[model samples]
Target chain A: MTVKLYDLAHSRAGDKGNTLTLSLIPYNADDYELLRVRVTAEAVRHHLRDIVAGEVTRYELPNLPALQFVCQQALTGGVTTSLTMDTHGKSLSYALLEMKIER
Target chain B: MNERIRIGCGAGFSGDRLEPALVLLQQANLDYLVLECLAERTIALAQKRKRQNPPLGYDPLLERRIELLLPDLIARNVRLITNMGAANPLAAAEKICGIARRLNLSITVAAITGDDVFHLLSGDEKALETGQPLTASGPLVSANAYLGADAILPALATKANIIITGRVADPSLFLTPLMHEFGWLPDNADQMGQGTVIGHLLECAGQLTGGYFADPGMDVPGRKNVPDLAHLGHPFADILPDGTATFGKVAGTGGLLTLATAKEQLLYEVMDPSRYLTPDVVADFTQVRLEEVGPNQVRVSGGRGQAAPGTLKVSVGYDAGFVGEGEISYAGSKAVGRAQLAGAIIQERLRDRFPDLRVDYIGSTSVHRTSFGEYPDPYEIRLRVAGKASTASMAALVGEEVEALYTNGPAGGGGARKYVHELVGIVSTLMDRRTITPQLTLFQS
Candidate 1:
């Protein structure tokens, strides 16, 4: 089932050639370890490359535990998969909201 | 002689529909009927009415309603205290008195006014956001802060059966007559608490009873196939002289009153529960309890007391921003996805051209779609954009883009329309004294 995408991370340094530059936001140690065990770096890079059209840089699981993402600007072309809109008409920093499993 | 003085709090402003809210008072059935309708925005409307007409310049609907129901009310001998005097309450009262005289009924109508403080403010610019001299924000649309009910005492003392005012707080409307009848001092903490709780219970008419309750199963009076909802609409309170109080919406309304609905409204817009501040008193909402008194009414009691801080919350709404609405449809094979692409294109276009347009997307759907988890997929999307200034221009720009959607390419040929933008103000004012005796005038027909 489609779920709310939480633990969002935004692009840190603008990477032009890299198809998937990593964006990392501080995360909990437990959650970081959990995602690492479930989701792999290659799977994320491939999924991101289809939308980002950039090379996937190496994944960095920070010691501080953070929301790690293979990043790109929000896609504008082709078919749309899922859309999340804010009521206040402004882009929010991914770091501001916490992601949780919908009960 | 109905020794039991029942006070009903009337919400909203409808000069035309005013009688239904106050009809019970016609027979000395109740001692007081309080009509409340003066939000920061409504005050602005009142000012606009004054500019358009010399006096009694409101919607005129309430006045018309009063004219129709005056005979019955007079025969009933019920007293009324209302804030129906928007821009010119005195003018409104004059009109009511005229109506009374034409019917050969000698009724006393009194008006309480002059709380409009927009002109009295001097020095310090009203800062838009704590800037410059404290007063230099911009031209004030409406500057009437929620004043204490003490101002109405002067008018109530006139022994005029009816009292009218301009922009009184909702709770203060019900509490004013109580204060006058009970001779409760402004500083009387216990009485103040009692009155405050009483005001909350009656403020929403049937709302306290079962109007907005949570249980769908509970058989609410009016909703339960009952008739003459009016006769059943009686909200009562068991208030003590010490300020301890419990109350519920009487009966005769079609709604439910459960712990959920009671708690929801109880927490509605309250900043500090321990000190639920109002113009009348600093009340405590934290310890209040809600119990089902009957099928319809819910008793609210046990509110603690708190010392009020000096600052008064003045709702001041200024031009926050402007919003624009437009629509687009998808008919192609990948209709939904194509519509999404259109939204993206519009956003891209706005960013490229204005670089400042704040746009948001809202999708509307008739059928539920499982693609987005539990929520259904929206067939049509409503796109909105708002900005700090030049909202009209932004709205126009969006309108232009929407019209071009048909000619530029695909994405359905849905039309675009512009909506109006209006904002008011509510600011907090600090006052050293607790009470003020306002000027009262009686107009007799």
Candidate 2:
């Protein structure tokens, strides 16, 4: 079944320079392995291709049942120079959560 | 039972809430109260202020924060630590001492310096991301290294009532006290890593206490989905000698402390779980764990660390020209068309002056920029155009062009606004730790 990533996890976004890092922590601990298998770096890159100008990297944390994705060149010119109202990419987490995941 | 001490966070940033800090000082039996007030670009702005007038480069709210919490801190015997010093720790320390004297309170203040490396560094230093040399990046404003707890330990040894620092790592503000109290050495990576986790969690004050974790109808039980943020309580930690800690908020204060909140904060700004770099030690957050021990309380432990990095990260700020922004709103039937027309009109008007001017339709693609599904023809739209220029006056022209659209192009356009300001460009580089020496100056009242 297709379900939104938000239904399975919660995320928080933070940025440094042009890289936007999103932390995806599963709502249920048991879903960690499933998410680890389904949510690939390529999947995130494909989902955010419109915004991300650089590559996407994902780091796993089985202990926290979470995944951390660093989307490079995601912030137009980052905090100091980005003209976007949401300079820190704080809303990007919601965009990532909107991605469809197979349940 | 292991020996433990309580540490409370007063203010997270330069402009954080002051009343909650006062509450922590008056109510919590805290041994130390750390207020982290410096951000990446804050020191650069402070340096700009200092250039205009020396001794004015500290946190603007420093005096107000001191006035509000001074008496309570003294009464509770809580020593204070902060990077509120910004670009001038000595001046900030002197001001604090002066305030203590006015209140007839005797105290010792220690100011830690030597974070500024602008003069020491060669102009050819390469930026981490762009690989562009510093000399090629216009006039420099400030270059401060992220110093570690080593500098702070000496100030703590002096037994100062308040320790003011410039450009120390955020986590070091909390980690230094734990190391001092527990006699944790510099090479104790595991303990330092554990302490770093606690420091990182508490560094943002209310972030781990449901302030930033709240989302309606979401989040798990024991986690407050709808938080009371009006009187948001700052975070405090009860740390054992072994580096395990329990996080909680002050009693009768608004905010929730839960395992979920702790987990959210754990990964904040963290790039890699296996190698979180800081001046003190490279902490590994992958092994960390958070458990809800009781109501509004969570026990956090299991942070492992590796050897400290030989080089420290430096934030170099340069004059990046000026930015001018202008916005105008259009509503009614053809709002989207009107806004788009207004944006094009401004772009045409400022094409010669600001060839790189950028335009955004607020209701359409202001944030995600066509990333999200297309917005249906909206009832209202805000047209915004912003650009960078060599001088303030040139930047101001971009905004002026947008304001002209109200009368010249778009019908029903209103709420036109414009602004021009200087921009500070930040570039990160690393410096060998051995080159920068941290020194402490003492002031007595």
- What value does DockQ give for candidate 1? 0.02
Share of reference contacts found in each model:
0.00, 0.59
Q: Which regions of candidate 2 fall more than 4 Å away from where they truly are?
A: B217-224
* Clash pairs, model 2 backbone: none
Model 1 ranges with Cα > 4 A deviation:
A1-103, B1-3, B12-28, B56-61, B102-104, B123-136, B211-252, B307-324, B328-336, B348-356, B364-376, B385-395, B413-415, B431-437
Summarize candidate 1's per-residue lDDT along B1-445 as a digit string, tens digits.
2223456544433422343454344432455666555544566666756766777454356566567657766676667776677767878888888888888989888888766655645534343324354334334555555656777777777768788887666677777767776677878765666677667666655544433332223233322233343343434444444444445443433344544344434543333445667767788654566665665445556655555446444433233334444555554355566566666667777665555554444453211111123344555555444332345676456656755666774556454544434333333344333333356888887
User: Judged by TM-score, which candidate is best?
Assistant: 2
The TM-score obtained for chain B by all candidates, in the order given, is: 0.78, 0.97
Model 2 residue B95 CA deviation (Å) reads 0.7
DockQ of each: 0.02, 0.64
